[model samples]
Target: MQRPDDVRWPVRVARAVLHAQATGTLIAQYGLVERAWPAALPAVPATRLGVQANCLTDVGVRGMDEAAVFLAEHLKLQGLPEAGEPVERLSAGGWAARHAAGEHSDADFCAVIDAQACFAGAWATARELVSAVLESGGPPRSPGALLYAAVVAGGEANPPVPAAELFALAGKAAAREADALLVDLRLAAYTLKRLSHPPGALGRLAGLVRGTGDAERRHALSPADAATVRALAMNLEALALLKKAAAAVRTLEDNLAENRAGHPESVGETLSIAAYFHYREQDLTRALELIAEAYRLVRRDGAPDRLRGCRKIAVAALHCGGRTAEAEQVQLRMARDPLGFDEEIR
Candidate 1:
């Protein structure tokens, strides 16, 4: 929001998540999410803070805000750093809307500080407790947000923090937290593997893409998870981790195909990511197709800013495809928006 520069921490967190989810277009005007983190994060696929916030929110609701309360109390007790004044946590309905669907009854809601030592920097203790969470699970949900938090908090590295610890943390989380939207698991694993062992990660992603052809899973990723794919792919692309990025983009595209029936936002967002990847590869034909598809989705969804951004991309793609007059017409359309800011582009 506000051009990214003017935003504060949580909103900054939100912006980062949105950019990761599918560039700045998906949540350009609204449809943002922030989960509690070091403070919190908005609901965009690429946001670790959102995962963390959502994690705490999930565990809390599973136990009726008990887990979340303990986290706050644990932070206070350990004097772990936090920002902003403490605010009341959301109710279960609110959490369910943000996280995966759950059916935790009132009895499931209780405060348990058993992970206090784990959360408070007792490494062995924390790791063991996390293992217990993995072992003692019912249905899939993101229960590893706190562990991810601990790993991030513990690692302070100009020389790069010991990645083994991160691997251990993410590895465990990824196993049990199969909730698609709880992308903290995959994000952490991808970041770690992408940075340290690119080839292996690439292979793993390729397999994941191949595996999506199966019937049970069917590549039906929630919009949030797909955005996470987009975000991580962007990161990999930036690092010149081309193979891994390609795999991620493929996964994202497949996800879009499976779930595009009723969700225009996902369609528009993933199309943008796909279009950018194609544009980078100089596949102007596919890129223009993607841009046009995304523009239609954005307009159908009634998002002016998103439509404006889509038109901009169309102009670029049209110019690159040697269709200069078409690009000019798209530019003229931008000038006609209510804001009139695009008039200056002329």
Candidate 2:
């Protein structure tokens, strides 16, 4: 909803928060927070809903127990909880007692987990979210779960749900057709996406999906390439977080053209990711083509790290395109030792 010229503080924060989550990019707890408002501390969030949204995001990422406490008090001061009926009351003992007694399916459960996750890791919160999704009478609500998953990514994701359930439920949703597919569980995918060191739990989940090789791909890029990777990933994350997948495709298409003109090498990386969006759009042919181009560039001119990453991306693109054998080959190449190279792709 941002205009080219009218982009401001609130939009930028909103964009950054959503982008961070969508790409599974882990924003560090103490990551340098750049202010978009330029010395003005008085900046309203883009929308009224953003008031709570931004506050909740900060609480989870920074582990601001004081802020969480303040938020609870402020809600009470406003005659909330009962007044805010659906918004669960911030009663630590009461909530915790319920949680211990396995009564976490309450509608307000995700909110409670979101608040407590400010102190605790996102793993337990994720587990609770999964529980909520499993228990939903109707469909999964992707946004709320998406928000929590991204916020939780600022910390480690220990994935509280049994890996098997995560694999079964999540994999089924990923494979289903547009109509029959569970849209809400896409948030579940994002939560799992945030898992970096998915040794046992994630490894097992990867195993559930026949030969997708989705989880086998590790990040082979180096610290030197971090900025560019972050930029592209954040860009995609923003679109996904906004739930504007189709529009995101158009936006990224324009961005890819601009980047291609300015930084030719960057096209491959951006295109590789654009392929992911295309895959989401159910355009496997386009996705494979874009990824193939990226793979060519990375193999020819990419640095050692980028080559490895591009290979991994190629594998992902192929898997999404249902070209599993080709994806495996790419994975094998990615696993090979570098041929001695180092340079920024963008």
TM-score for each candidate, following the candidate numbering: 0.39, 0.29
After the best TM-score superposition of candidate 2, give how far the Cα of residue 250 lies from its true spot, in angstroms.
Answer: 1.3
TM-score of 1: 0.39
- Maximum-TM-score candidate: 1
Per-candidate local distance difference test: 0.41, 0.40
What is the lDDT, from 0 to 100, of the residue 235 in candidate 2?
46
Lowest summed lDDT window (length 10), candidate 1: 106-115
What lDDT tens digits, residue by residue, belong to model 1 across residues 1-346?
0111111223233233334444332322122222222223322233442112222222111112222332332223232223333433343233333233344321121111122221111223223333333333431233345434334323222113333353344445555323432333343344443345555544544444333323124556544555544444333333335445566456556756744754443456668667776676677888788877776555543334455667777788889889999899888877555222242222
**What C-alpha lDDT, on a 0 to 100 scale, does residue 46 get in candidate 1?**
38
Report the C-alpha lDDT of model 2 over 1-346, residue by residue, as the tens digit: 1112111222233234334434565242221122212111223234432112232333113322332332232223232111111222223334344544556433344443433332222233333344444444422333443344334433334543343333334334443222111222222233334443223323332332322222223333333233333334334343444356787688677768767756464576578667767877878778767766765565443133445655565566677768788788766655443421222211
Q: Where does candidate 2 stray beyond 4 Å?
A: 1-243, 300-305, 320-322, 337-346
